[model samples]
Target: MSSKVPIFTLSNGVRMPSVGLGTWQMTGDEGKTVIRNAILAGYRHIDTATLYQNEDQIGDALAELFAEGVVKRDDLFITTKAFCHEVAPDVIEEALRNSLKRLRLDYVDLYLAHIPAATRECGSHRTDVKVEDIWKGLEKLYSLGLTKSIGVSNFNESQIERIVKIQKVPIHVSQLELHLYLPQKAHREICKKHSIIITAYATLGSPGRMSVIGADGKPLFESTKNIPNELNDKNVKALAQKYNKTPVQILLRATVDMGIVVIPKTTNPERMKENINLFDFSISKAEVNLLEAHERSKPERLFWWPNVSEHPEDPFAAER
Candidate 1:
């Protein structure tokens, strides 16, 4: 199709695969198998964060793949993010090195600050650290070749602009909670102006969000049960029927059509295949716009960081 998925080029000319595997709760031997299967199923990009606590397993999966000659480290685009505790300028590089140790990689293709909020301890928010300092630390990592590209996750428009204004190294990507309901038009525009690519984390089926255990052995976020599932939306259903694809497929393809990268997570091998098989059909520009506009009207948000929501530096502080 004319709208087939294409690799997104970062401002620095790094080619990132449009579709990636999101490893949130994927862990243990099972998680390793799922990661391995996803790679075999055609996903070249893998996203993980130190907060996820699954880097070791992912590293094991990749190591096995490399030893088998099924895939080389150079063939895949691996991304990992440092948690808030490591956001401090002095701690960022050391934290990433530990993550690199766990991931069994010499360097990551992309590295991100998990959140804008800085903390001495992972959960205890600190008001003293500057966002610009974090950017400098990320820039240093890029210079040292610990990460090929640097970026941020869950940063607000203002926080992003402040960094952009002072950035010695451009923010190559921004990871955000983007879905049909929260299409993030404003954030997209800002990133577009700075040539920063965005990686949208899937919120397609967020029912168990509140119960997701964080590294501290507690629920990660508040409940998302109130928001209607996009897969159940009538418009999404209609689109699926018209395209002879599933509702999940329609949502994924429409997002890619909007020029944003998507990382959909799944432990089920069958669903993993379904998520990556989005290139065969093209959702027309008119349809994509309508789809985004339709679901956005209701504007439901599926995830909320209750832990850091009240922190002074939190971008989503108003949402509380």
Candidate 2:
């Protein structure tokens, strides 16, 4: 099987794979095996975070691949984030070093401020930190060559603007939980204006996972009984039939066609292969619009992290 995935050049001239393997809720031998298989199946990008607690396993997988001559160190694009608690300016470099140690790498392709808000060790939101302060640390990392690019995640337009105003280097990327249900057009427009690439997580939404719960201790979805599954939506199904592709493929292709990078996590090797095979087909403009229209009138973010919603810098705040 050919192990080739399409690449998109970042504003900083770094080449990033259009689709990456996400290592969230995965670790140990299982995480290593899945990451290895993903690379063998043509995934050149791997997204992880210190918060995920799987950097060591991912590192082992990369080590094995290099030792076996399956791929070179420079052949992959690795991305990890600074946990919310580590976003403090004083601790940024130290946190990055810890992540690097775990991933067994000297430098990362990209390093992101995992979340806009800062939190205490006990996981309570800290009101003292500002997004700009954390961004200054990222700038330091960029200048030191520890990370080729630095950016933010789950940040709103105002928060991004705050960083951009004080930024010496361009924000290279802005990762968000983007999908058919939450296209985040406003944020996408902001990123486009600044030439910041958007790396979409949760692209497939809650495919097979248990229903998410909100801050109110209530199910996010009232009932799977009456609501239609996005993957099984009539519109998505119709497009799948038209393209002679699976519903998942149609959904992923739609995101790629929009020039957005998507990372869909799955431990299943077969699903991993299927997720990266998006380069073979193109979704037409009309079909693309049909998929885009699937976006909800009001976004229903699956990972709002309500505990931080009251934080001043909370991107999910009503004012934002």
Candidate 3:
């Protein structure tokens, strides 16, 4: 842990770094190198999931670092999630053990339910498996000390509330696709009231990934044209100039100022260095207000799963 980066204390009293490296699309030897470089670059926290398929690479990097005495096991905070299909009560522990095997670690600092919806092996949504049942499995893992803490990702307020009401352990964090363009204020408020820390992914507005062309090479989201790129936004650029910082720094700082943790992924060494160098500067209250005002009145979600939206517990479809 770099002294420059601050750490947030979870409700369970675990310390988590406020800024982390997200290993979403990173894989293979290249991904291993990226994880190694990020650790050397002062990133004490790293986020990955079973769906990412790069846990082994991350494991390799951490093993090297630990073997070389570059960092101790306790010095790092690693988080991984169980895939939606593995959320069933019977499969939860097995799924976690498999992830631990891939990560080459005895335990993970935090484990999350990857999504609110459940799925079967045939790639079909399972409406019968409820969130409460999956939560019981998470509680089992926590009690066994397989994970120091447990949480959820991509869960809405109502779904989170349902779990919280029946859960024996408190929800430690809620990971979401949040950035300047899509602040998700409503969801943030709900989490805040319940003492659930917000972990933001796609913190950069996912610059070239907002819209993807389909198999026929056409746009995926209809509102893709209406979404503004935060990196190129006039307001962001002006703020960068005013603060003598890059747009990325300004955007990341905005989230940090609001007490939100950000995990911005990048394999570029230079960008990795730049992402963690956000603590030296502080965005003023007025400037933060102006930056927050840049949020769209209507949400422009970059990630949408229309196929799973029909699920009864679909977090996105549920009202806030």
Best by lDDT: 3
Q: Candidate 3 residues 1-320, lDDT tens each?
A: 77999899999999999999998878789999999999999999999999889999999899999999999999999999998788878889999999999999999999999888888877699988888988898999999999999999998777888988998998999999898878888889889888999999888977545345655677655555667778998888998998898999999988888999999989999999999999888888888888788756676777775656788778778432
| Each candidate's clash count | 0, 0, 0
Q: Please say which candidate is ahead in lDDT: 2 or 3.
A: 3
- Once superposed on the true structure, which residue ranges of model 2 sit more than 4 Å away at CA? 1-4, 208-228
lDDT of 2 by residue, 132-250 (tens): 98899899999999999999998889999988898899899999988887788999999999999999987887553444455678765544334345687788899889878888888
Against the true structure, candidate 1 reaches a TM-score of: 0.94
* Candidate rank order under lDDT: 3, 1, 2
**Superior candidate under lDDT, 1 versus 3:** 3
What TM-score, computed on C-alpha atoms, does each candidate reach?
A: 0.94, 0.93, 0.94
Tens digits of lDDT, candidate 1, 164-198: 88988999999999888888889999999999999
What's the distance in Å from true for residue 258, model 1?
0.6
